[model samples]
Target: MRPRYMLSGNISPPSSAMALYSTPRSDKRTLQRNRRWPGSSATRSSATSTLSRSGSMLSSCLQCRTSTCRRISISERVICLILHSRFSFSKYMSESHLSLRVCYRKIAVDEGGLPSWANSKYRKYTPGKPHPNAIEYLVAVDENFFAFNITWPQDDSKKYDDPEKKLDQMRAYVTYFVEYDKQQLPRSKQPYIFYIDSRWASLKLMELLHENQLFGVLSCGENMRPKVLWSWIKADLAKYDWWSIGLPRLSANLVCVRTKDKVYLKILTNYCALKEIQYKKRKRKFPMTEFYVAACDVQKEYNAFKCKVDQLNKAVLEYFRLSRYLDDKVTFTQFFIHLFTVQSWTYYNACTGRSLSQLEYRVLVLQELAVEILPPPQPSVLAVHWPKHMGGRTHNCQYSPCRNNCTYFCIACEKWGCLKCLEKAHLNG
Candidate 1:
């Protein structure tokens, strides 16, 4: 018999009080945030029940359960999601000109089972099938945002006995990663970070990173382990973007690196925006009038509401534990489910014509407790309009390099100098 698993829509919360309320909740904006609905809070539970239906959808798709893997069936929502994802992944595969077989993880015959595999000597190391490296790929998930880290070791011998196979594997992995980022992850919210240790840094990989618009330190030698607080700043921020200009490694001292990076400064600048965002959040605030009308005892109603939330959250957490992220299909489908579900709940709340209760608001706030959004980049003046001492400064002599400012500038040096200086600056001045 297949057990059923249902997934309904929900919303995300603010970043201030994540620890207090870990359940999914949100406001009017984020999940297509301002969407409208025809129902009220009374129907919210029904919506969740309808989505889960028999809980079969996820069971069929992923064999895991909330606490343990069990026999289960797939939900219509999850099935449809899987189908949609296949189409998208197919399109991506076609565009990248890479075969699908290569992109997915390689599965093997393990008939002997876990105990046998565990006892084998070959299994102790990289073995026939390679084990994943911690530094190479790491995922740090919070309520609103996720941070991923990818690195290559100083020595590349463990991956594959054949060097060519390793490179192919890397390319395939990177292809999926890039696409997964575009399709699933929300880059508009904040830039994704990538840390490429110089050890196995490839030209093609670096090019891919730059296409995403980030910084890089042109290091030719070994990796630098961070020692100081400032350098740690670079280390921390570098793991969250597609390409990070990683800290220049110079000995064990953090300050020894040359040319400080603006990423840290930019990150610091975002703190102010983060605070503003926090200030703007509406939390733990419910519609008192609606609550008063709905129940004779507001306190009792509040307690029941809190209990309901807790129970639902537990179910969600349990179901979520079953799946693994080996492909974009699962990640994206799950994300889509999570995304729209959140919006639906928020919209439903609005329809309920009730103000959010303190407990509800707190749950919403918890969703974003760890998430921090980076402020949009400020607009910059064109190079043509910049002052000579700004980006316009040139190492060339006072001679202007261009003739548009010929009256008072030196065309040879792009300097704002008298025409006379053009002739004498290089030779005499």
Candidate 2:
């Protein structure tokens, strides 16, 4: 039988909390009716009766109990709830053309204070990074603002030979999604568009995407191949201000745009067309520029949907954060725990069509988990026994089942009994 959690206390936020989300009348009513906590009297009684048999309670030893509680399994329960519902994962994937954003998150640590057992190749402290003394992870997030793929943690302390194994890591990350689509999202026919930054973008990676029938919008640097286009764009930067200078290619379109700040933004996209390039002009004061900032269709599209992985990082960090002192395994475990919570939160929004603040959702999840993992308190048993000493007195046993004369008295019940009756009255009781 499937286990059900019946929490026996009020754990929901006040009704006014719903006002913050401005939830619809129907959703509000549903939440009030369905939110589980101190449910009906029958449920509470049933849960109490099943607590010991269900084996949900923690062990007596602290270390053994901690080891038994697996957060990953708990997260899987959240996924199970979503899967059993009418909401179809494959359908959702097919309906939306998701933008897959690839990025990195630094798991900072203190090098000097690290424990002796923390001897990992990837846990070295680089001198000049934002998280110089930290471990790094290659993370991928979709348009839903939830991370679905994560690479093994990289060792940053080694010699800076390659840029995070540029082409190799990209292929690995893309391969995961491709396989996932084939298995879990069989109906998802459309290919995903990956948003890659200039540092990680390469010709080989672009070719890989093409071979897989996927699309990508990659940022190009000034030194990127095809020196002719970069040279022309740099020479005539002002002329292309507020204009999308398109150099169409067989597999990609090289787009260059100049903003009022005098910075040239180079973009390479396989999905965009020369005719689809939308340009707009906005006048500026201060410097008295003719057209301040040019908004190109390619740039606008990239800016709007990209950086979702970064956004995921922001969302996770806003509430709780993992301790830096943990080892690599424990740290990654904590990171995924946070990601699972965010995933559940995103799923809730999609299912309900209402936006509940992250904080509130986290509170609700905590309360629900409390019900699943916390066991009901047990009633204290009365310990019935006699005093250690016996005075020179004889009396009949006061126990209902015994009829004897002796000098044994039970201090617990303040009763008398004989030697044989005392054993049955107190010791065996």
Candidate 3:
């Protein structure tokens, strides 16, 4: 079987694909778009996209002779993949096919900020001169920026950053996206969204941004704030598109309408189920205009997900309720009986791909009948996570194979949790 890797439309790392949710007060669910990480659509125009004169390193690797060793890139970030005659790893690895690391880096003097690599004259090229760790640089760097961390124990408290290298890392980051965009971006295009995940990273980038006079859309949540953050950065806020809701917040999927005041955060619409309890309890503080439209869009998405969940559950229940007769040994069409006698939904059935016995399968099927409705577990967006660095009371979230990957919990309605089922349970909920 061809190996499959998860990819997101934005510039984020592959494994960190987040299934974002709109807060209870807001009806919309969203996977906030990353402006720097343009989806597959952006790759069509390579001339204006990532690479400069060196062009894409991975694509350029096509000229590699069989069994030959060739280094790719015009910057410090480099990756080597072996190609063999029998298998088409080459076919599988293409610009269209998303890899989790930086496939290409730029080598422009204006974009390059760091001291030269050995091949600085002929070094690996990366996206603009972003810090190799910049969200956009990481996207272009590899198909999996943190693949080692996917199976990383959620409970383990391992620190990845070294304090000494922080300034250097931050410099690389600003060079990647901010500097890269300044060079290749068309004058007509608005800046792409660069999500700031931590307070320190935000502080460092904002500081570098003012000094360099570069611009991009920066989105972040509440925990990212320090008391003096906005106070100092507010002056240069207009230099770029700084999209945020000052409240301690989660990333929303729907495109947010930008405003100067916090009143937009309080605004809700008639269509949202939350309108009655959250917004109507008090007098309206802000005038509702475009936000009224955004609220409606959120509701529309939520309702669609809600309807899909209800329909799937009803079908699964009905299928099991009526499948008994066909499951019998003496049935004419025993194929489906075998298919479901396995009890596809059960944890063991899915793992072993078999039931311990027919009687055991029957018991498992009956268990499904007892539930009036089974709401699958929901996984929260990876962006709005309860950090792995901080230990929590809930070890493994209410999802998965005891991998200790449970890091998310919903205190809003006491519904849905952790990473495993975030998309199914949380989105539908």
Best by TM-score: 2
* Position 393, candidate 3: lDDT: 51
> Model-by-model lDDT, in order?
0.26, 0.48, 0.28
Ranking by TM-score: 2, 1, 3
| Model 2 steric clash total | 1
Q: Mark the 10 consecutive residues where model 2 has the least summed lDDT.
A: 59-68
Q: Candidate 1: minimum summed lDDT over ten consecutive residues — where? A: 268-277
Candidate 1 local lDDT, 1-429, one digit each (tens): 110100123322233322222331222221121112211121212111221221112211211111111121112222332353442222212232322111111111010101112222222232322232111211211111211111222233553232322333333323434444355322223333232222323333333334433222212122222112233223423211211111111100011121223322211000010101111112245642321111111112112222322232232233232333334344334443543333223322332334664346335434433232344565544434222333443343334453333334333344665445544665575
Which lDDT value does model 1 have at 375? 45
- Write one digit per residue (lDDT tens) for candidate 2, span 1-429: 110111123222234422221212222222121112111222111111221221122111101001111223333435543343532233233323332222112111111112112445555554433444445445666565545444443433333333335555566556655554554422354566788766556555666666666677777665455444455434535544432222222245456666545677777666543332345555555675454343555677667666665566667556544465566777555555666677667655654456998888878777777776896776445444644346777777776667676776766667777667667655576
Candidate 3: lDDT over CA atoms? 0.28
Q: What is the alpha-carbon lDDT of model 1 when measured against the actual structure? A: 0.26
Which of 1 and 2 is the better model by TM-score? Answer: 2
**Candidate 3 residue-wise lDDT, 1-429, digit = tens:** 110111233222222112222222221232222233222222222222332222222222212212211121211011121122333334333454222211122111111112122222322333433334211111111111110000101111112232222334334444444444445523224332222222123334443433443332222233332423333323333211222221112211211222334421111111122121111122256654332222323233332322322232222234332232332332212322332232222223322344454455556445554442565657655545232333465555555443455545555434334554655565665
